[model samples]
Target chain A: MKTSEDKLNEALRSALKRKFDDFGDQPNPSSYDLIRARLKQPRNYKYLLLTIALIAFFVAGVMIDQHWITTKSDVLSTKTGIKSVMQKAANLDINQAATTKNQLEENDSVKQSVSEPRTIVSSTSTKISMSSVVPALSPATLPTEQTNIVDAPEILEQAEIAALPVQISSISALQPESFKTTGLNLPAITITEALKSEPAIHTNSQKISWLLNLASLKTYQILTVPKSGDRNFQNFKFPSTFALESLGYKVSIGAEKNGFQMMLHYSTFRQRYSYEIAGDEYVVQAVGQADYKIVRPGTIMNEDNKFELLGIGLSKEVQWGGSPPRRSPQRRSPVRRSPLRQYYASAGVQYSHTLNAGPDIGWINAGFGRQFAINRTVLLNVGPYAEFSPLRLSGKGDPFFYQPYRVGISLGMKLVRP
Target chain B: MKFFTSNKYKDLTQLVRACQKHDPAAQTVFYDRYKSKLTGVCLRYAKTRAEADDIFQEAFIRIFNHINDLKEPEAADSWVKVTVIRTAINYYHRTTKEQELHSSLDYTELQLDSGDYEKMMDQLNVEELLSMINELPDKYRTVINLHLIDGYTHVEIGEMLTMSVATARSQFMRGRNMLLKKLEKKGIVHHENF
Candidate 1:
């Protein structure tokens, strides 16, 4: 049973053990120090990169702020150049004081009273009057026999128009300024026609006014809803939209043609809606028609919201003589009792691309607008506008009154295209 | 498996704790205790003594770094052995080589009984046998040394070297036959010696 090969292998194993019996090793003592010094714990390198990026962003923001302030000073310097140009133009009117006897006699209704029969040298007055047109035509210049009492400002406005190149057909638009404490002077619609004709007057005021009106304009708007149950609301009973619970902002840009304008606006706000749960307020954010997030007390859960409105509108000065024609007071219904002081009411059809509960972006904004003239070149428009998205016409007592609305305030500055 | 490993590693608690705390004195004791055994393991997979040294250093560094994460002090011996073995295998993979892992041996499917191998060992020179192992090809040397000298199972050898158990068994048997042939040619033949 003991093969010769087996016996040899047995002997070989014994010899191998005997050979390595004294085998040993001694590593250098310095190696331990080397391993210990370079010990590394596992770490996520991504987080380190992210932190570095955030610090870089913070530094860049500081640099941008410093540059922005420097640029703002440059804007001020440009504003100074404009003021100087206005002064130079005022000093150089081509035709001065053309008040002939026939010119005075023909316009018998709007006669200017000269204090004495002596020949008055108007050259001295003309130089002073040309500098500040508004200041020159005081109420004392109006004829005493003109029956309609008018504000001194309106008289000055008439005088300013008199200084323009075109001849106004009637001056009756200046009469209602005194008798009626507050209403738009209807005949001032003449100004829109005057602006449309492109008169050949290269006066500085006309040039500035034309440049302001020539192009599509952009405006910033602060969208707001009335505060809930405040004194302003009790008196006016405007639509209450304060329950939405956040600030809103809007931006609009568009072209104006013949006192009719169409603008595209994008607005952002916090859309909040609430319900009653167990006799307590359960505020919820409406992310979509079917999607909502429940809110607990002390939870700040206001998410940003955006909507687009394409509004086509027509504006006109208010009529003063008779009762305003009841051509269906359509625009006023939406903005009826808003407490804001408004002028020049306008009607417009607006297509809203709000986070729609029903159709995707519909003709939901049927509303009103109030355009206030800030200067000859700029205007501010603020009014309550209601979206028909939530309206149910079948409801009682004019469902229109129940519709909540947001206020859009747009600042329009004149632009000239090349 | 981690819990079982932790439970068994309890035996090495004092040594492991010292390594975890980075105690240089205890670390010296720990490293010295296993260095020779692990170096022997490293040498079997390495082509030369320099390669063996590199493998040994890398394995120990890994052992110390993760020593704190090992919960069972008693299993440290098995864990360190596996680490050194893995390090050697990894080193072989990382290096470029033309060496064949398994050499073809003669057809001999016979296995010797315990007494038969004992008699064979008694007749052979042990130094000559180890030197002949170094001369063996890469995979044959690895399989034979891991199986016979280290007393590892075929399954354990396959796991360490990333081979199937059957491949490990085949390489081992072939390595054994080749070693016997080499010894026979060196005039340490079975019947001739007897």
Candidate 2:
């Protein structure tokens, strides 16, 4: 026999059991079923179609705009410059030396060769003329036979007619023959040497000018100026400029150790100058400078000498779609495309700040990324992304935001068909 | 055992498949088949029938929404059970404060006439044996409910509650001792030989 207490406890247990048993027999109609039913209904097809169409339209527009901007800017800078040089050549008389000097100076190489006599010569003359100069100067007086002078006289004569002054500087300052052997740096006599040579001594200044004019015409032939009809010019401009500006970038023009630079400026995001260096090849640099923002306040300016390579060989035209057709003979040539075509893999360590409904927080991430062309117009990139942020330090003492570090994979593709 | 061996199992599987396809009739069948089990889970956490019904409905809704994430169809019973438990815990946490503040006014009082009371008393004799479990604390109530009614072992209970098996066993023994003491005080059942 049980006491009242024991009976009460037993009764309570039985009640709990009965309650649970009731649950086993009850029906559960889930709210999720209604939602799913609505989603699965055929009547929603029109909305689904409209959503898909809108997303497709957005993606198409972005791709088209990216292609347009890239092509336009590339033509404006690279193609236009090359075309102008070619046009100036076609209109001028090859017999005139004065015009030839003007044409040669316009070439970026000639401008860069201001300090070197050999670079000056190579920038202005053809191979035949360059060969003629080698024999005229004695081995002892000339820089070593790094540049063969078989045709040195022809180049020297033309330079003399163009009123270039020839200076006999010891060859010690010149780089070795192997260094000068690149496609752009051919051998020839400098203007200074030509001015002092026999041709200038024998001819009257007016006669010399006539001969210079004729030589300019021939010089034009060897340098292929980009033609006006070049399809690249028509499409490669706006996209490249737009791409940089959309990211709040401003462009700066100048020279760096590697070559001429077009830098992208972002004052708020980063104090450093990000630029594309265009010379032997295109390189991307992130240059650190003293806080010139304080000195020039609100003005975007180039650093005098602080440019360093963050990465290299980034071609605006190729990225933006103004890239010349893949099947073109010039495209096939390693010399013409090699500089811009090389792939680069880079690693960067960054500190990023994120502000959310919680507290402002900071994180550190180290990433390694590789950019390579799938074809002339498409680029693919993949990288591992890992970020570390302290949960305690994030979101202004909010208990709900306690998720710490996030790790994931990032993959990207760019259509560069220009 | 019959459910696993009989044609009803095949029918249940077919109903589940139809439910996956969003067939209303199949969903109704699926609901009818499993509703009782889910309701039982809900009742464990809810203080009243209405609350339990709400929890049961909500648990089913969550099941339908997240069914795609379930990798194993054979584990559906366990999966729904776990989901219901989690949902009930969440509900408890949310409503405990409100329930605590209104404990007095919300409490139900019972009244009976002498003759009716005698009949009731006879019925209560058996019920009283189980009702004493209500005097136990919430944690002990859950442990006793799981162990005695649901037939879960201490190790399994420990895993569900994220506690060690030994801890679950110790808590169970402690709850049993408390119940024994309360029964002795009420002059209910006397403990003699084990």
Among the candidates, what TM-score does chain A have in each?
Answer: 0.27, 0.23
Q: Give the 10-residue window scoring lowest on summed lDDT in candidate 1 chain A.
A: A330-339
Each model's lDDT: 0.45, 0.39
Tens digits of per-residue lDDT, candidate 2, B6-66, equal 3533654454555565566555555556766776566555655556755666676666656
lDDT of 1 by residue, A250-308 (tens): 55556554334456665544433321112123366788898765433332222223333
* Per-residue lDDT value at B63 in model 2: 68
TM-scores for every predicted model: 0.33, 0.31
Best by lDDT: 1
| Candidate 1 to truth, TM | 0.33
* Residue lDDT tens for model 2, A302-354: 31111111211111111112223222221111111211222222222222233
Chain B TM-score of every predicted model = 0.74, 0.60
